[model samples]
Target chain A: MPFIKVRDDLCKGCKLCITFCPKQVIRMSDRLNPKGYYVAELFDKEGCTGCGICARMCPDVAISVYREDKKEVPA
Target chain B: MKVVYERPESLLDVPFTYCPGCTHGIIHRMVADTLDDLGIRERTIGVSPVGCSVFAYEFFNCDMVAAAHGRAPAVATGIKRVHPDKIVFTYQGDGDLAAIGTAEIIHAAARGENITVIFANNVIYGMTGGQMAPTTLIGQKTDTTPYGRSVEANGHPIRVCELLSSLDGVAYLERVSTHDPKHVLKAQKAIKKAFQYQVDGKGFTLIELLSTCPSNWGMNPLDSLKWLEESMLPYYKPGVYKDIG
Candidate 1:
């Protein structure tokens, strides 16, 4: 399943990523990070298409999306 | 697993000082990515204005200069002239470009200076509190215009792209928004094109991004994005105002 990974320490919990996700896969966690804002977490990995909306919309660059079917662009 | 997206390397590691959901952060990343993609990060010098974008120097991972209140165009012109080989751009807000720096921008485009301008038009001034800017739509209420802006009393919103499009010296002019993901992608392309024009020796490229000021708009992030689509889009129609390229 495609998934979303958020760096808890870097998240400001702005919810922008959650707001822009068309798949509605992300939710604000009740738990607060060191920054004291609620961090976002993926609600369901199975629903993700890895369109990269959440990852690109993230202001803090805290989220990264991975899709198993796709190949990495070699650096 | 394939990594779909990550932070652009041209952006610094410092956390953004932008307010939650502010589109400035998104615009910043796009410019940084464009510079990195074009291998111009080392040669780019970004000038930031005095509004909300004042702290932009801290965000972009390039050599940054802070211009006086609404003088980024003048500053950028000087930089580009002195270091002709360096890529020069300016990050400016609506208030900075449309209001106070109107002369600077007009003359810069008039003279066909080889520089890129990333305009973030959020309608209200973000840094010094929310006051109605020159681009604020009619009937829009702000800190200064408590009831609403009356066209008769305040005049109409200045569409910067449309105004500058008439100038013969402008090489490329576009207006895009950050209202949604698809539009964000388009905005990135517009920003990239604006920068690419300068690299190709095209003159005075400007990409005006219709951004959202949620805190001042008194709306949540989601609602602000919706407002940008419903309200701001009608007044400032998104399109290529001019493309001499």
Candidate 2:
């Protein structure tokens, strides 16, 4: 389950999160947001360890992370 | 939900290189916990000084920059100015801030730089062996001061907060200690206020933390903390020296 969502509007295109993601899941996209900042895109949600490092280093409150109950079955 | 104390996500999983019972970890925790509560962990830029706490760059999971000896304030100033919206702060130990970096911090506050400073005062230089520092109390004995610090020879310990608080540009100043649980809690409150003051667009903020360096002090952790209370606290009482917030 993808828990970390990057708010395009607030992203400053710093790419710090991309550099710090231990899972190598976040990357800068070619598509620029309205603010002209490159939005970070997540390639794999399942690989996320819920470390929240990306959320902690975003420089902007652009990322939100949540953990899904592992016991829950898919609908 | 059960609550438990743990390292913040903004901190790395790597073990700290600091010595056992060093108060740097406690100061690190205070800053990280503040970031967690303010939900600004992602946006914080931590600047590391050149002394013992220099490796703080590795411990913090957030964006961190290692500044030259006693020059964290200068580096932090640049970062904050370039990224005005980002939460910028510098963590410096006694020698780094109160000694060589003294001019940098004074001018930064004089310029009213919108940044936060976390100053750890352990009285002695921990990394380069226990040398006397500007914050070392008079009559304190160290490797450099084998016969005890003489006021005539070294002068008195600098009162950093008092000096900074008198500056017109300063918006927040607090002196706290990490020696005990009670003081630790109070220090956290002051640390939170320092960060919050920065976020609120207030002027320069500095949190002077009276810390203990057991290894450098040539004493056990418990005795060092006790020395901090009995010897250091009287000279540097914990309180908000100035608060515009």
Give the docking tier of candidate 2: incorrect
List runs of model 2 lying over 4 Å from the truth: A1-75, B1-3
Q: Which residue pairs collide in model 2, if any?
A: A56-B41, A56-B42, A57-B42, A58-B42, A59-B42, A59-B43
Q: What is the C-alpha lDDT profile of model 1 across B116-139, one tens digit per residue?
A: 999999999888889999999999
Interface RMSD, prediction 2:
13.1
Q: List per-prediction Cα lDDT, in the order shown.
A: 0.89, 0.82
DockQ of the two-chain complex in candidate 1: 0.63
As a TM-score, model 2 comes out at 0.76
TM-score of chain A of 1: 0.87
Candidate 1 chain A lowest-lDDT run of ten: A66-75
Worst 10 residues of 1 chain B by lDDT: B1-10
